[model samples]
Target: MRAAKSAYPLTWRIMDALEAFAAFVWPARFGRAIPWLMLAPALLLVGLLVLGLWLIGDASLRTLDTSTFLMSETYTLANYRRAFTESLFAVVAWRSLAGSLMVTAATLILAFPYAYVMVRTSSPVIRKLLLIALFLPFFIGQVVRAYGWLIILGNQGMVNEALSLVGIAPIRLLYNYWAVLFGLVQYMLPFAVLMLAPALTAIPEELEAAAGSLGADWLRTFRHVVLPLARPGLVGAGLVVLTLSLTDFAMPAILGGGSQDFIANAIYDQFFRTSDQGLGSTLALLLVATGSLLVGLVFTLFGAGTLAMGRARQ
Candidate 1:
């Protein structure tokens, strides 16, 4: 019995010694570095993006020679000039900017109520139903959703068939700017709701109740109390929706019928259709700048509405 007890203690001692040796060898002693370690993947991603941007920036300074189907070996500002001066580029850029803004606004408006209800609702069944509804689209994928819209909105599809039953002629729903916007709004709704849900969840319900107790109506309580607290989520969600909408290619491609093109569509046409890497790179860099500017503006204006969710208390 004494020998067995001694063996157990000796085994524990050996395990402890191995652990100490491993810790010493690895030397991950810096508690401060844990945060940096957590951020390593993000930092790596950003670094790759920076490298890609640098390459694009270099490419943007060159012009494509249509005759030779080759880029100019020497640098030039012709691509940038063309981006601003060309009517096609201008129209596409304007459409993308306008669509992104509109989609962001619409998504936020729709998502807020949905997120609020999802967070505040007492019934498990309703919450589950809402979650299922939101998540169902995720499995279907963006391309599929866009295609689903195509099927539903096609001349002979369900929507047109339903309209024909009412004695109305089949309306052209797909292959237009409005169709692209509708698809974008539908696609972005779930993302916005997901972002807003956590922010809504963070707000204490007691604050709303207290406001009501202090002679505030439901509307006033929402406007004054809940809205202010939910700003972080709203800002985060809006930024995500805005950036995504601005860069979206598929919806515009499928729904726009090649006429109502967004910036991404234009970029694709420049790169793939025309094989003009110089112009594509220029447009890509410009998009990055535009998106960065928007994010900078938001961060500058509202310091309260940070992207970080439940940041470390320290």
Candidate 2:
């Protein structure tokens, strides 16, 4: 066995030695100890996340004393109570929820055809162009893109400039609920397409051709065959888009221009503007919980996570 190992390439020998060291350090009873060892960095990151969550939870339970402008020594649920009882918080929460849903729906709708065209096109030029368009926005930062929208949609900007030529009045496009949603949809489209592309790629063109030969039209083929096969991607993309839109700060902050506040914006205001760390922590913790819940719900509806898509039987 030692002679056989020596005959192998140096890289393979090194890997074998490393695997043996791992099996020795971590007992074989642990099973696949090298893989577990490889995950140490990720596990440490998760540990740090849990510690931060604990700190946030502890802060969430404390109440601020307005008199001293400090948190109460004793923990209480007053911040949570206020979070639930406040009308403004409710409004912001509802707006975020509704806006995220709309963003997810619109993003998926727009992304599907783009992804489909990119994946199914026989023309290499068409595929490359589609890919370039999809990836171009990714190179631009989200904040920059949001600001670009501001430039385009501003009253005195190019949009209105063009509108003026067409005999249309300068309209108030920025600083509204719709503006925020539009920004979110734009920000999320690339992500949706990237996620959908893999699933769509997994679907063979032969399957689509088979459907067509069986007397199924385009729409019917998409509805019965393509849509069902792409469930994992849709679920994954929707969850990502929804949670990101829900927790977004930049789009609402930049585009909404202080009128439309998402949950993250509200948390920011609490932390910075109001100097209410306790309330801010409460909102932060609640946002985490909400995002986790949404992820869980999506995972439950779908089979598994994006990475776990083809490994269900395993």
Candidate 3:
């Protein structure tokens, strides 16, 4: 009985010591609120997105009965089949893909040199002015910008007038592939510059200086040092531009001018013009799928580029 009483007191004292230490190290009550506060917004956003997607999917499954404009009943795959078998959808998809690729490539080619100069130059005034100029177009609405392009590219517009002054007949520039390409590049160029500028700035100056000292010229340094470091930014920017160009309805709708159409425009036409909700849903889903795939590919490339860069540095 005496031994048992002694052991109980010792065990209780150890437990009290552990409890005091834990309380001193970390206050259990205070930390609970922080995680909950941080998690609330994320949970709310996820719930809303899931709810919205579910509603869209539900609406997509139902078909409109022509007898009554409001009457929609039955689920069918006919809409999906129509989307695939129909030349209109296929043509639009192909055009969107091709146009997006061209626009992305063009933006990269144009923005890279500009971005490099902006990052490497020691002139603050020039850099600030150029940065402001790059972002100025975004201050204007896309529709307004599109209309401005219309004025510039139209037959009776400034470009044609200039050509006429030079003794050349007004060439067809508006409402064509070139016009669309021009508009897309103009819109996407700023994004490319913004992405590339940061990446370029992140590159250490010593790398370039060392390369020069070792007999590597500017082009060689850029190829060996700058290009590899900038790969992630390039891939990210390209993906963003490509996706924007692919889904962009306003540019194609305005500049394409019945000559061309993208998947987004096709979706718009189905929903509003033809009253084909099912088909439109399928097309929308396809657009989402394509965007997801493009994003996945970009991240994969980015990961590989990052890993390769790390290995090269080692």
Using lDDT as the measure, the top candidate is 1
TM-score of candidate 2 relative to the true fold = 0.89
Count clashing residue pairs per candidate. 0, 0, 0
> Per-residue lDDT of 65-171 in model 2, one digit per residue for the tens?
88898888898999999999999999998999889999999999999999999999899999999999989998999999999998999999999999999999999
TM-score for each candidate, following the candidate numbering: 0.91, 0.89, 0.85
Which segments of candidate 1 are over 4 A away from where they belong?
A: 1-14, 20-24, 27-40, 304-306, 310-314
Give the better candidate number (1 or 2) by lDDT: 1
For candidate 2, the per-residue lDDT at 300 reads: 73
What ranges in model 2 sit over 4 Å off? 1-32, 305-307, 312-314
* Winner of 2 and 3 under lDDT: 2
| Local distance difference test, each candidate | 0.91, 0.90, 0.84
Can you list the residue pairs that collide in candidate 2? Answer: none
Per-prediction RMSD in angstroms? 2.6, 3.9, 8.4
Off by over 4 Å in 3: 1-30, 304-314
Model 1's lDDT to the true fold?
A: 0.91
